[model samples]
Target: MLSSKIIMTPKVKISYILNIIIVLVSFTFGFRYIFASAPLNYQLEAIGVHGWNDIIPEYRNMITTFVRVAGVGMTTASIGMSIVLFRAFRYGQNWARWGFAGIFLAHYIPLMCNMFFLKTTTESNPPMIPNLIAISIVLLSLFFSSNLKNCKAIENK
Candidate 1:
């Protein structure tokens, strides 16, 4: 009997490890927002009158509510995508590679823009440099690795 097992190349192994990193990073952000939102809000309030309080009272409330809701929503979505991508990539699904790359770009482009353009201080930018680097590695691994091509061929077989 012939074995049907797919051999994981080094690139595939690296991609898998990077995928796990992305999953951990996503869950960390989700839980951080879910648990620390109150303290975060307080810190934002303490920044100055030019911060959250500058807007009208009703608008400020609305904005705060929107932010909290969006944070939770993004957290859930990130986690969900992490799980889906993890499973798909384990089986060498080509779509998983593209999906992860697309999702990373979608989430981070605006985040990087905010970090670079909107935030004025290191304190305000959050500790996202490592996460950004991990994400970049995942993208590069997906795009340039021969393992992804092998995966695509396997999927088509």
Candidate 2:
């Protein structure tokens, strides 16, 4: 029988750790959106709409559905991105690096933009600190791991 355990190099290990952190952050916010009402209520309260569920139950449900959809998007996107990172990005695949960055930015940048728009238009401060941290981690991973000059050496091993 042949063994099939995989070993991680230092660079790959760093990428793996950072990718895990990104996924965890996404999961945390995703589950919160899906399971909790506090975050939605906070935004509602910010716009001077207290007891949103009591006042407009149907509207509340609609908004909650949107939030939950976003949560699902975040969780799903992170899982997909992690797969790419683990299988290809950490292996110095340039195409994987670009694909990950493009998909991640496409998914997250709009979210941040919506938060900013909400803050400016409705004075609602959505929780975006975690997202900013995740973006920073993503940038760090991409910037540090993007050097593919040694990819040939890695493949030769």
Candidate 3:
């Protein structure tokens, strides 16, 4: 039947769901953090404040560039990934498969610090919530990535 033509694989379905969730997380928390979190953290007297006495551009450049680059990448990628996720639902396209993998890596791996500890660089750096969401997304993606049916199997030119 036409209704049964779609695969409805749980793995692929979960991956699609997680992709949507990831998009929301990025747009809400990630975007807000990019615009405000770093400056707020620096403003905190408790964060070991060093005044603008030296104003060393090298150190400033290093730290600021790292934050800015990562923030911009997250913002742009989240938007793109959301589009890809929608495409996956309809056509199960090759780009979405690979895109999901990349998003999983970028969002998830940074959460794992060393073997045990987790690193969350948000302003509050709130206990485990930030990283927990990321970890959950990672697990979901891994469980449902449908990587076995990746670009190689699909006809993409």
Candidate 4:
């Protein structure tokens, strides 16, 4: 019988904790967008676009549709990331390490850039601090999980 246990170092433990935080935060925002449409509405209101649904029902519907779709995407992706992180990353798989970083960068870098992009076009102040903090957490997680040499128990498997 093959045992499925992998020993955890301090760095790996920290990585696991950070990954959990990422999943929790992602799910929170995702669910809020999906169920309440609060995030996009907040952004719209910040830009002084009040009563858009009353003034322009069609446009509001379209934007709401987009927000809900984004929410679904975020939620689903978070689930996938959790699976990868828990099953493979904790085992110190090299592929999982790079894959997690790549997925995070691919998903978030463009969104962060778009936030700044929107700032130039609209009067809205994009939530830069939260995005920065999220990126920092992910980077720290990656740093902790990378180049670990103590995962030899499962390294050859």
Which consecutive 10 residues in model 3 have the weakest lDDT in total? Answer: 114-123
Error of 3 at 111 (Å): 6.1
lDDT of 2 by residue, 1-157 (tens): 1122234556655756777777777778778777755447557856577666555777777777877888888887877787777666655566666666666788999988888788777756777787787788887767655553244432333
Winner by TM-score between candidate 3 and candidate 2:
2
Error of 2 at 2 (Å): 16
The residue-by-residue lDDT of candidate 1 on 1-157, one tens digit each, is 1122245677777777777777677767666655542335433533434455465677666555655664675586577668656566566666777777777677767766655653564335444576578667877668544465474323324
Per-residue CA lDDT of candidate 4, range 59-124, in tens? 666777877887887788688778778777866666776667666677778878888877777777
Error of 4 at 73 (Å): 2.0
RMSD of each: 5.5, 4.0, 7.0, 3.1
Question: Over 4 Å off in model 1, which ranges?
Answer: 1-5, 39-67, 120-123, 151-157
For candidate 3, give the lDDT: 0.56
Q: Which stretches of candidate 4 lie over 4 Å from their true place?
A: 1-3, 38-42, 45-48, 152-157
Best candidate per TM-score, number?
Answer: 4
Clashing pairs in 1: none
- TM-score per candidate: 0.67, 0.78, 0.55, 0.85
- The top-ranked prediction according to lDDT is 4
